[model samples]
Target: MSLLGDDSTESVAETVQETREVVQEEAPPKTGSTSFKLARLLFGGVLAFMAVDNFRNLEETVGYAESKGAPMAETTVPAITGSLLFGGLGIALWKLPRLAAGAVATFFVGITPVMHDFWTIDDEEQKQQQMIHFLKNLALLGGALAFLRVGEDD
Candidate 1:
């Protein structure tokens, strides 16, 4: 009766069962320790704050993009997308710690250089400001990774 062949029905059932088992195996523990809870809260809070701050300054960010010769519309879209992605990852951190941390780390690596290109600036003060922002993001990325590592053992 199956379109594929006589073997298709059994293969489909096996795949479904395997998926269910994988899902069950990956489910988070019912009770998390205090340290794990604190880590999640801190990591999520930082991400949420950064997302909001970036979104609030979208106009300035777009202007910076324009200075770099990027189209305003294209630059604005990524800014908005990053804001939403960060905010969502912040929420996900509490529920899926490891995945959230990895996502945030990847995002930080992608955006840091673009956001703070100190090499492109000649003024010392502006260079320092860019370096500071770059370092801050690195610190946050480290924190997220640490939190995820600790959460994994819980």
Candidate 2:
């Protein structure tokens, strides 16, 4: 069966294979630029460092998340930390970078609202702190998105 609707003669498998070949043929030459590599390492290294901190303070992290009304905090804390660590490593090593960028983006998006609900906080100081964190996360999200578009020339 063809996925392109009626009147399509090509099967899905054939179409996919052809698309893959075209992509491979059109892929840009690897630049291996030192500055770009350094930037990736810096971005990914920060994530990995954060993951390490989370791992070291798993219980405290979970408690904080629970206080923020995160459901299943105990399980979620570790899962999130693991994602950060692995994603950071992948991006740093320039291995499957796009996928790693997605993972990093997902982590920030998932954590921001849950952990920094400034509107819900009544204390002025705490609210300000949360708002700052929220804004920082938004900036980080932008960086991750830019990373996702790193090699679109292909």
Q: Global lDDT of each model?
A: 0.68, 0.85
TM-score between candidate 1 and the true structure: 0.61
What's the true lDDT of residue 1 in model 1? 81
Model 2: per-residue Cα lDDT over 77-148, one tens digit each: 899889889888877887877888888899999999999999999999999999999999898788788777
Worst 10 residues of 2 by lDDT: 1-10
Clashes of 2: 0
Give the poorly placed runs of model 1, Cα more than 4 Å off.
1-31, 68-93, 150-154
RMSD of model 2, in Å? 7.9
| Residue lDDT tens for model 1, 1-154 | 8798879988998999999999888956543667656656666776766676666776776677667655464665466447536634653456565566666777677667777788898999999999998899889777766755755755
TM-score of each: 0.61, 0.77
Name the candidate that leads on TM-score. 2
- Clashes per candidate, residues 3 or more apart or on different chains: 0, 0
Clashing pairs in 2: none
